[model samples]
Target: MAAPDELFCWEGAWGLPSVSSDCLTVLAYAQFAGAPLKLRKISNPWRSPSGSLPALRTNQNETLSRPADIIIHLRKQKFNADYDLSAREGADSLAFISLLEERLKPALIYNSWVDSKNYVEVTRRWYAEHLPFPLNFLLPGRMQRQQLETLRLLRGEESLEGGEELEKELYREASDCMNLLSQRLGARKFFFRDSPSSLDAYVFAYLAPLLKAKLPNGKLQQHLKSLENLSSFCSNILLLYFPHDARESSGGQKSSSPPQPEGGDYDHVPNKRRKQLMSVLVALGAMLSYAVLTGILSIQHMQKEALEAPPPDRQTLDPLDEDEEGDG
Candidate 1:
């Protein structure tokens, strides 16, 4: 029997294992190692000892939090899965995974949270599904604010700014990163030749969400698609390891993607009507908020006008001053 009773993780998106790359990495590690385990979906990480999802709690009363740590633990203690990796390969995998975490993670946050439409329509709703009622109402906002603040600090900006220009820049950087990975992969099945090292799981965890998500700022996804070899690698791994999520392009599926859970289709996060309604609501709210901000400025301008004296005209000007102007 597998030691872990439940692998806690964020919920799936479009039938993928998880929307969270961290969760995906841990889960993929288990799957690739052929470890027996159960998945536990969650909306928030408040209950976790590490205060994060993707926690691995074992039946032996051991708890592991953070995907990287969980994967390492699995390899060393649970699966002994890295026997194929030589000292050199293991060192390379370690360095590559670190690079992926540092570069790709912020871009994921930027695309999902900084993009208004995606946050309102997709990310918010998806998160809301997992939390209790009142927390559901507030936590998403708090999380979004955190993401925005992080972006501002990253960009060295004083105020929140979200638009296509920012997305364009972020996605360009992301595209370059993907292109480099694609070149690294070339014609190989995984990062280190045919065998999937720990690096592949980490990469797939990050890429799967981007590839499957239908976010408003889909430039990230578009960049992934343009790298055909990278797309194939993800598809092949999804088919081999996460067959339930491989419905879209996998050949000869025994069945379609995991049947939509009770209550709604995950792709739309309930139904078409609700998603449309959310879209309209987001658009209206954005316009209203913009108007309010500008309206405050306009109101302040009018108040200034009311307080300040009018510009001096000929009636208010003295003859001496007029002569002074003429002389000058």
Candidate 2:
């Protein structure tokens, strides 16, 4: 038997299997397809083979970073969840997925990273606490910037001056998308019938975080809760395929580990040691850079202040010299 492909994804928090939507998407798709995957839940992306979350390391030793590419690879390996879908259903799935990316994604990003209250109180705090020390200081801010850029690109704007107007627009579009999805799902156990498919995976991933996370400004979450079907849909997926995650999210302790990969626990010791070494080296480097930068800025600021200061009073010194002459 071949070793299961290894999936490197963000660590679960706030009760989801992973905090990242992209990671959740791939994880759900893999589960739906029955792909044998060794899950490595991590806070630091640098530990992953591709230096990114949601990376898949195949049996052939190839690394795939994108969720779409990982799904395609799984399908090629004969683990396709979408294989049972009819042509029309497949088309509908594609259309709905596209709609999700355009309409729902920006608001998700905004709620997670751009919305000040949620970002500060929830999103940033979660990452900062979970991530390794120096990375805790860096990656959350970097991730926020990337999400903001993604929002700008999605809106086809040079920049997004996020305010009430922008938030209103994003929330409105997302709410409408959720309503449409609720109408389409309409009590169906899964999106495409009894069995889950790629669309179910995408929908579950996109909605689960919003449903599960405790955002400070929860306008979209409020709207989602009002649409009971959509809320139930996310809950059903959690209870069905991800019971462990559901339990953890609902405040229960994790009683057991997810299934392990082919190797024995001892086999990973060397790799674990290596990752620790790398983390230490990276932390040291980051600290060194910060120190050097701080010192340089301090020196420059002092130089500027010195140049701006008035010359010392020579007249006062002359008075002291005359007093010495008079005493002589």
Candidate 3:
């Protein structure tokens, strides 16, 4: 396989050179396509035209930023790894990709950022390891806010200030998308059956980290574990293609060993997160209104006092009110 000119992306974590899902998506395609990609890790997203990672500069000096665009460019250049699907199958693939992109992406953001436990333990730590100190501090938070904003905009909502309901809805939507993918894959060797498609790369990219990471919330992890075929599908892919990482993860074992939870010791934490978001927002608005009203009333009272009272020296001092009882 001829080497790629260069691929620019965020550095990896968990003993990887490129740990990001998007970065891995691109790498996985290149692998399946027999494209030899040389990775160039970048700390700053500004290095790319879209201010994002996983940008590729091809042998012909064409710069592509997005995964779909990169794959299209590769196909056009006759390095064709893209599935030559029938019109119906192609449409189906496109729909599935959109589902993963729009719905699944936000769920990932929730796992990494909104989930307090995952953010502190896994996501933040991973990003911090790859970034400079201050940037490590700022970037994770900035990413969280940006993803939250994106979710808000996608849902056609105004603010994420009281977004618990939205967050819950997003989680459900993501889970549904996952289940749909699982059903579609449905014991097939690959989504396209024996011939891997670009969607397979995306599947591996998104699931790899979540499945492996020892996160605190464990909801996302648990949800993934529930999908038996999906788990096997991911494991099988790594064992077949990425034998090194797969073998290392399995302690030098050639085959993929799906990690098992011991003896039904899983925590079924009741999602106590309530649906009182609207109430909370309304309460806050009321408090703000009360504060404004109080301020206005206070100003009016001050004005009345000023009008009713004479200047101190000119006023007759009431004996009952005089503190010192001076010369009574």
Candidate 4:
């Protein structure tokens, strides 16, 4: 067969470590589309849209500089009417995009909180900052630091505190997403109603990092092992597109064993529980403040009425009677 059409050619880092999951999802979709994908290394990791390096160039001669924009462009192209993209397939793609946006937001907020800086500073610190030692050379180390730092900031701790909570939340959300996919997929091998669609690629891409993540505790690892299909999809994609790296990473292990999926009583909580809790707390605080203000207002109103009411008419009759008696 002739070489498949190349859809995405990325340079340097397509997505920052904070959102690499999304980056992987993008790649998975491209690969699933039977599009040849390649990554060209750049001397500077911090190259921005205005920078000289071209991050993405499609077969159509279109160039995209940002990861978000790149995904958007891909969706529009792949799902275009002329492309005959299926409705169900398009919905999956949209869902992937939505999940990615949700995942990236907190990371952005965490970066801002740590640096108290604008988007540029946060993005630069995340993608371009140099790390110490051998870790500086490894992609995982570079990516890990940014992720850890963001998590630290989010937890408001000096170190990677609250990662448990963060990880839990991530797992919950991802599981919910995956669960939806599982239902749709049922016994089918792919996400598309009939055949494997671009959605599978996106889902796999976003999930790769999680599959590769070296969790300190067995929690996340165990959680991942539970999603058999997701695990299978990730492993299959890694083998196909990144065989050498996958081999080296897998260490010649022949077993079809998936990583032990993390499990706990905590994982089953609603995915957005933390967000909901925060909203409830905010509402409660606002209501309390309003109640206090109303109480103060009521007291002030009563005091004003007491002060303004005409003084009871003074009894002047006694003085008049005294004067009349004196006259008599």
Give per-model TM-scores: 0.70, 0.77, 0.69, 0.48
What is the per-residue lDDT of model 1 for residues 106-190, given as tens digits with 9 covering 90 to 100? 6788878877777876798778876765688888898899888887776675455556677777677777778889988888898
lDDT of 2 by residue, 1-328 (tens): 8999999999987678898999999999999999989999999998999998889999999999999999999999999999999999999999999999999999999888998988997899888768886898899999899888888898886468758889999999999999999999997889887899999999999999998887768898999999999889888888889989787655543332234343343343435777789889999999999998989867766776787642356447777999999999
Model 2 spans with C-alpha error above 4 angstroms:
251-328
For each candidate, the alpha-carbon lDDT, in order, equals 0.76, 0.88, 0.73, 0.51
Cα lDDT of model 2 overall? 0.88
Backbone clashes in each candidate structure, one number apiece?
A: 0, 1, 1, 13
**Which candidate has the highest lDDT of all?**
2
lDDT assessment of candidate 4? 0.51
lDDT of 4 by residue, 1-328 (tens): 4332232222212122123444454555555554445554343434423332334666565567665566557566553221445666577567765764565334333333322232233333333333222333564344546665666564455564444565456556655666665565566566555444556655565555545643333343455577787777667667776566676555533432253243342333333677578679989999999998989867766776788653344246666888999999
Q: Which of the two candidates, 1 or 4, achieves a greater lDDT against the reference?
A: 1
What ordering of candidates by lDDT runs from best to worst?
2, 1, 3, 4
Q: Identify the runs in model 1 with alpha carbons over 4 angstroms from their true place.
A: 1-5, 44-50, 150-166, 248-328
Off by over 4 Å in 3: 1-3, 14-17, 41-51, 251-328
Report the error of model 1 at residue 310, Å.
63
Best by TM-score: 2
Considering TM-score, which of the candidate structures 1 and 4 is the better prediction for this target? 1
